[model samples]
Target: MKVDIMKKRRTVLNGKPFSIVDDLTKMDLTERKKWAPQVKQLYDSGTRLRFSGGKWRDSAGKSYIFVFNLTLDKKGGVQKTNFNALDACLSYLDKFSLDDVWRTRNPLSSGFTWTSNIDNIRCRLDFFLISKKLVNKVNDCYFQPPLQSDHHIVILHCDISIEPRGPGYWKFNNSLLLDPAYIDLVNSLISNYSSDPHNSNQNPASFWEGLKFTIRNNTIRFSKLKANDSHIYEKNLIKKIAQLESDSISDENLLRELKDARSNLHLLYKNKLEGIMIRSKARWVEEGEQNSKYFLSLEKRNK
Candidate 1:
């Protein structure tokens, strides 16, 4: 038998204590027999459930918030779901001390998060679950019209303040390694450094360190130049997309152009996220092997 495991995308913003978990289960909870085991396994994952009341919590005791398309309505009262699946989910939340932010904050609220164009059917299938202790911080919850999908965007507003953070250390951008121009520049820098006679009197260690410092400074400048170009290009794409959307509202012929622009923007973000993940994995592997102080503290704190 083949079994598929549910995966979640957990993101932690800088200076933010709580994590934002995006559900990628792609399982409809109403299909109890098919999804129950997967749901159970997901809830049983130690990484997801272990952070409650741990060092992950903020000053307000908020540890993490889950935003998911659960496909089961707890408030709509019209959507059908297997009793066993509902009970399992509710029981898991109760056991983990989790709270349904929307249900608790707005009991009488009625909204449809999904719609079927074929049958004109609507259902509330999205949810925001958070620590019960952070319920009071929920300022408001509402749903917006669908942009390009049948599902509406669920917006959860919280009253928590974001702590301001200072500019952190600079790390080499691994993506630059793929750029031919950057590679040529680096080669030129190394060639010049090797041929310079002014540093020939220096010791081996000092010479190596000086070469690294020079490369670092040049890399920083190169990265800044590329970043400026990227920002300008992204801004232009955003403007073009907005214009296409406005034109498409009146002329349906522009819908294809709008979609293409949106896809390009999405691809841009996807590439950037991939770069971030690569860097994060590389850092984790480097630090893990060294048993560095930062990772050691992180492991102990999580434990």
Candidate 2:
């Protein structure tokens, strides 16, 4: 059974949601009481979980995530039947609502999880799952044996700080030139500048500089007229939402208004993304397309 961890409580292959527990195979393994605490500690220590043997895709088309299970015998050895061990791990994850955080490549640099006894099958049995909130806080994780226990110790280097970023300048929307009013304003500025005798005898460099200054001021003025009001409106809506949240008693209508405002804000952001993608062509080009011969052909044609 497939599972969509983000939406459905049970597994779903794709978008559809369904629930049916599959058959289970009974096998001998250690109880959960012994190593649950240790597992939880590592899980909480910002260590991402990963599967050593197979590739499993998640709802986001991601193959690996922070999937982990621990069903070791009293002697700290994997059960004879590995299936039982795997089942235990899945059940534990469901019980705790834990998700995997596996990146594209394996994060382990060097580590020997279990010493091979027969055919030199040294498996990396020791795995961990890092909390998403603490993923950024972790700097590094690796195995270092012989510190205290015979089992390899997973060392994590974490140096995290909370700092506020300064407010950046807003981006200008060049597409505003499509508006007839904007075109007319540009034409009026150009005509007025041309008619001024002060600019008639100016040197080539000075004429270019004056033209640039006039265009810049005109753009800024139009931007303030069109964009600034919308920005202020969004900010005010945010402030209203915050005020409502802080209040001891919030009216239903006020809450609805806030939700509507947030929805509108989201729509505006969606439109902005679409506009940016349209203007900034090739920014989101697919892999292998960047260095393709097709780009060279286009450059030649343009020239």
Clash pairs for candidate 2: 2-11, 2-12, 3-11, 3-12, 47-130, 66-100, 66-101, 69-89
TM-score of 2: 0.33
Q: For residue 137, give model 2's deviation from the true position in Å.
A: 14
- Cα lDDT tens digits, model 1, 1-303, are 112422534333333344343232232333444644664565555323212110122223333222223342322224444454345455556876777776676565444565543343555656666767667767886665433565655677767657677865777787899999999999999899988997767899999999999999999999999989988877777667534432214345565666676687667765665554454443445332433344445534543
Please report the TM-score between candidate 1 and the true structure.
Answer: 0.41
lDDT of 2 by residue, 1-303 (tens): 111221244323233232322111111123223333544553454223222222233323333312233222111234243454456556645654433333302443223444332332333444444434445555665443321232444455545443567754445567877889888988898888878899968987998799878977888888788778778876676555434433332467875875676577656655554554444453365642334344444434543
lDDT value, residue 294 of candidate 2: 48
Clashes per model (N, Cα, C within 3 A): 0, 8
